[model samples]
Target: MTTSRSTYHHGELRQAVLAAALDVIAADGPGALSLRDLARRAGVSHAAPAHHFKDRTGLLTAIAAQGYDLLAAGLAGAPGLRERGVRYVRFAVEHPAHFQVMFQPDLLRADDPDLLAAKERASAELRTGVAGLTDVPDARTAGIAAWSLAHGFATLLLTRNVGGAIGDDDPEEYFRSLTGLLFSPQLDPHGGE
Candidate 1:
């Protein structure tokens, strides 16, 4: 049987290390992450991760950048603001490790070029979704509100704070209903009571 210490080809090392890092984050949280541990998990020498990531912060920056790109992709082409919000929540639930690392700026290089670009891409996608809210008096504030609802709900779910309350309920469907309450005609600025 191949051992955990089995060597990977050069081209595979970076991705192998990243996958190991994600697994570590998922199982033990980011605080438990270490390049040496990831190297061991990826079956590489302890110094292998540094060849690709430079250091722990560099590794986290890569993860954060990747997370934002994934978030942007998930949000892209959504039909409307509500759908985009649902997609956002889905992304967080589906990629909990990435979601966990993506928001912790203290653990990342906030000025990393790839991270900044990916973040902007995700933001632009959300802005596009908000722009479709023609009935809202202020799209910017509306966008923030929509994002807050989705992010907060996802955070609650991830933390298990809402598990019992939402037991057996389809999270996406529940989120859709919540969005409906917020975006109902009664709340539309241009709609008459």
Candidate 2:
């Protein structure tokens, strides 16, 4: 007799499939995802993952949504913009698979409700990091700059594109120093040095 333990319920199967997919992404990349492969890894029917996620985009959407939530959580406790930037880099390094998919809008269902909510939550947290920066004329532009700096550094580190130019220095340390340089006592918007 087939016991319930041998058969995962809907929610269980979904979670299992998501985990397996993330493993595949971490090992390979998001482009390597295959529902059949994920199903095999999860020990579920080939159709199981498809049923839950609908398609590759669906699965990636779910992952992107989850990534935003994780990023938001990581940034939530950060006390300042620099700390939040550090947290962002850490999150990308720790969750490479999620980070890879989170920014690839073409690979996800951008209109998915969960993804929208998650993205907003992350954006809000990011804004909070720069909210007190009166040195920047526009909070939105400063927030974007902070996010861009962190994201660029993280992506470069992940791809090893720095080409050993930063040899002997930890990427996190390098990033912190760079942020410090950029965020150091700001110039007056009125052309004061």
- TM-score top scorer: 1
Off by over 4 Å in 1: 1-7, 185-193
TM-score of 1: 0.91
All-Cα superposition RMSD per candidate:
3.6, 5.0
lDDT of 2: 0.83
How accurate locally is residue 11 in candidate 1, as Cα lDDT from 0 to 100?
Answer: 82
lDDT of 2 at 125: 90
Q: In candidate 1, how many Å is residue 22 off?
A: 0.7
Clashing residue pairs in candidate 1 are: none
The C-alpha TM-scores of every prediction are: 0.91, 0.88
Compose the digit string of candidate 1's lDDT tens values, residues 106-193: 9999899999999999999988877767766877887788889999999998999999998899898888878777766332233211
Quick one: best lDDT, which candidate? 1
Per-residue CA lDDT of model 2 for 49-155, tens digit only, reads: 89989998999999999999999999896767777888899999899999999998999998999999999999899887777567667888888888899999999
lDDT of each: 0.84, 0.83
Give per-candidate clash totals: 0, 0
